[model samples]
Target: MKDRLLERLPGTRTATDEVRGAAAPVGLVPRVSGFYQEWITEMKKVTWPGRKDTLSSTAVVIVVVLIIVAFLGLVDFALGRITQSILSF
Candidate 1:
């Protein structure tokens, strides 16, 4: 199977075929165009998240981050006050 593949594509391994000891053409143009072709084909197979799921995930991330930021801010303010009190003569 790999032998047949080697004959069909006359170029350096497409970042994957090289592992199977396939022949890779040492040409820069072929390599770049090959990468984009593979990328487009793979992207077509991807099942992207739906709009509602994406927005819900974004909101959840924002809320969690805001909670963490508020907690850190309170901790910083409390530490600043404690340090100021200790330094007072």
Candidate 2:
């Protein structure tokens, strides 16, 4: 099944063939065009998140960050006060 799929793909040489040193015609123009064609095809298949989904995810991240910062700030303040009181003696 993998062999059949690779045969259908545009590239002239399969991995085995390339490993066995079966030289395919190396050309700059054809390689660039083939790369771009495959890239565009892949880009079309991507499932991008919707605007609402993106906004909700961003808001969740921001809220989590703010909660973490507040907790850290409180811990720092408590530690600082304890250290100052110990040094005052």
What TM-score against the true fold does each predicted structure earn? 0.72, 0.56
Where does candidate 2 clash, by residue pair? none
Q: Which candidate is the best by TM-score?
A: 1
lDDT of 1 by residue, 6-83 (tens): 767876457565666857658999889989999999999999999999999999999999999999999999999999
Candidate 1, position 74, lDDT: 100
User: Residue 89 deviation, candidate 1, in Å?
Assistant: 3.1
How much RMSD separates candidate 1 from the native structure? 9.2
Instruction: Assess candidate 2 and give its lDDT.
Output: 0.90
Per-model lDDT: 0.89, 0.90
The residue-level lDDT of candidate 2 at 8 comes to 77
For residue 39, what is the lDDT in candidate 1? 100
* Prediction 2 TM-score vs. true: 0.56
- The residue-level lDDT of candidate 2 at 75 comes to 100
Q: What clash count does candidate 1 reach?
A: 3
